[model samples]
Target: MEQQKFEKMYLMQTVQKTIVILRAFTKEQPKLSLTELNKKTGIGLSSLQRFVATLVYEGFLIRDDRTKQYQLGLSLIHLGKLVEEESSIITIAQPILQQLNKATKESISMSIIDGNERRCIMNIESSYALSARNHVGDTSPLYAGASAKSLLAFLPQEEIDQYLDEVAMEHVTENTVVDREQLLEQLQEIRKQQYVFTRAERIIGACSFSTAIISNGRPVASIAIIIPEARFDEEQFDELRELILHAKFDIEKQLNK
Candidate 1:
């Protein structure tokens, strides 16, 4: 019985160390030599080699002979896509997006912050002949659009300040908030209101209203309705905002469940 417990503990330690080694690679450093991986992961060369060999055999990592470095293997891509397809938020939002699009006849988009950028992970295009369009993989500055603002507004003050300080505010359109102080104030207001409405902030002639979906006490994703500015109506805006907010709330409940 004592021997069995010791072996189980050793196996758990090995699993934890393997996870540390795997996490050492990132987008900025996709490939790493054994020496670098050792330094980054704090794992000794001999043990690292054994783990790396097993990982490569299992198709979780690949080695580049010329560079004598390892990179994430292709198998991860398939696993990542599977995770996205089955993600609770995506699964819940899929049917909701279709329903929202049918009711509003407007483009619906869902985005999450990817580093300093907002990545549109899902988009349901409007049925109207002339409508605003954002593709699933489209990326935009986090400071420039309603979809991003909803998420950004809820971040910690220090993070917001750091982001604003680090990111150069580009004038994507005439209506975009180019002044730092004004943008800061707007972010505060957005946090207070729990929503954001932007007109041509990122794309000319396009307007959007967005709200964040909170889960695990943080903004996990955002949903937005984008339409041509010419067709935007002040009276309809309130109604649409409520609908979007309701959808966000429902999705949040499912995510929390």
Candidate 2:
């Protein structure tokens, strides 16, 4: 236990040092040499060298060979743009998602693709005492769940193929589809119908209806309504489907603008 604690503390200190080095560059000093960075961060030259080299290798910093000065890199700009887009998406979708939650009294969510997983970026919980609860930042494999499959289904064919080729599908629940061929067929149907319905795939006793939010003829995210299986009504399915589809349409219209 003592050794583990010491190792963890050491790792954290190393991380703090890295942050300090990155923070040393600012608007007033957008680029810095190794000596300047050491002075600004109070880290020794040898340690600073290792940290800066790692940052440059990871594309978080770039060094000009001629000037021997380092500046923040393009990767930081890409990450900043991603954060901006996610913030914009949540801002644009929240009101519509609230309306959908009010109309159906069910959990409503917006999800986006994050590498090999689907991550919920926005969620409004159901109003009922017994509800299907999924919070923001919840993640599941791309091959499972209505929300996840809907996002996967809308990706370009090449991406879909690459994902299937690389990821090993494992069943999350008894109802989860782990067979690639069956999953492909389901994706085909989802594309043709423009919506996905699933039951107990990720969480037992939960059913979800999902559709993609598209911009510029490509899917940027997905919207889902989750409800308890006990309360699922076939008679009300059409109404619920229409509500989610309308939400998708409204969000997409605003996003495209």
Candidate 3:
């Protein structure tokens, strides 16, 4: 009886109970009625009503008045985008980026596909005097460079098709793939190899090696090393690929955690 009281008291934490209610919905079972939610969450009917009302009011949930079922709301997607933009990948990749800088002695960056473009959210420079010219906020077309290909390779099939159908490829350099058929083939190759190497594609005199960091079955960001064409060594290509892959794995692991 004493243990039962303690258990009941523990469940009284509003935040914990709210999270439990939210977690009751899954990918397999995205919508649930009030009775279903109560059964799954082990929340009593009265308390569940209060929590559901509050969550719905706050835009965390949407209720179907006709069916009396509830589903996740647009607010969660908005919150997820904010987290993607501000925290998870960037915060998790910082240490990995530092380590890559030390290992490669080349400029390293993390790029995310933002709409039809990719944004360089983080760039760590090598200790060496000369390196690639990339800043934290640099944005480039998703159809152009090694970093862009690494991201484009793992996007969903519909999104990829939409991209190919809509966007016009600009000829940034002679190496840039402005042809749709050729670029689609290249994207497939990148998906298979899990990396991309580009020579003066986006910028003249800059070569890049990149691989995507996939989380939850899709590419969230890409890890890349940029070097001047004069300094980029074919002999070091395999070594650099391995280094970027390791960093990608590290970031993905953190994201999963």
Candidate 4:
């Protein structure tokens, strides 16, 4: 092949294979064996072996000797942030998120939309572990999760349609919504309340509350809290919702001026 064509070929394969490898890291299977990766990705064993080896060498994945699996590595984390937005939203939100966590005694997080997915941008962990599986940089579908749903409730209907068209609904738990009409109705209610709350929707035995951070006529991000079902009651939800709305107001106020 000519040099130009070879460069293009390499770029295309690199893009395709990189995504395939990255998609292997899920909340449940953050660690995976080469056999598991091959099974999950449907890639040929030899190709997967070569690619996995290269990824480990390049510092994108690491081998866990005790678990006999591979997980994301620090190199990826370092590179991921460097390539991400200039300055960190996490740094900006950390203080406020920590205050919210202290006030609610819940696991607080701030998430923003990133390429059709909602990415957790910051977190303030609770004394009790709440949604330990998700932290900064964790991605979730645009339709599910309280933070995502908070964004969805305020997002343009066209984007919502595009997301529904492009992504299939995955049943994270029994409470996850699949019916379009029902989801829309729920979204309407959330809009009316200016916040979202769900129980066992994205993760079993966990519930979340979220409010959108609207700026310049668009949802710029969301603030959410993860609370275990047993620890919080409806009255407690009311208090947290008020705090989230206040946080949204503060963010918007800062962005506007």
TM per model?
Answer: 0.69, 0.93, 0.71, 0.65
> Higher lDDT: candidate 2 or 4?
2
Model 4's TM-score against the true structure: 0.65
Would you list the clashing residue pairs of candidate 1? none
Q: Model 3, which residues run further than 4 Å from truth?
A: 1-76, 81-86
Task: Tell me the tens digit of each residue's lDDT in model 1 across 50-169.
Answer: 999999999999999999999988888867954664387899998988899998999999998788988899999898999997888899888888998898888878988899889999
lDDT of 2 by residue, 15-129 (tens): 9998898889899999999999989999999888999999999999999999999999998998997788778788999999999999999999989999899999888989999
The top-ranked prediction according to TM-score is: 2
How many residue pairs clash in each candidate at the backbone level?
0, 0, 0, 0
**Per-residue C-alpha lDDT of model 3 across residues 1-257, encoded as one tens digit per residue:** 99999888877788899999889989999999999998999989999999999999999999999999999988889878867744888888999989999998899998888889999988998777877857888999898899888999899989998988888788999989998889889999999998999999998999999999888788888889999998887999899989988888888888898
Worst 10 residues of 1 by lDDT: 77-86
lDDT of 2: 0.93
* Superposition error at 227 for model 2 (Å): 1.3
Ranking by TM-score: 2, 3, 1, 4
Error of 1 at 3 (Å): 55
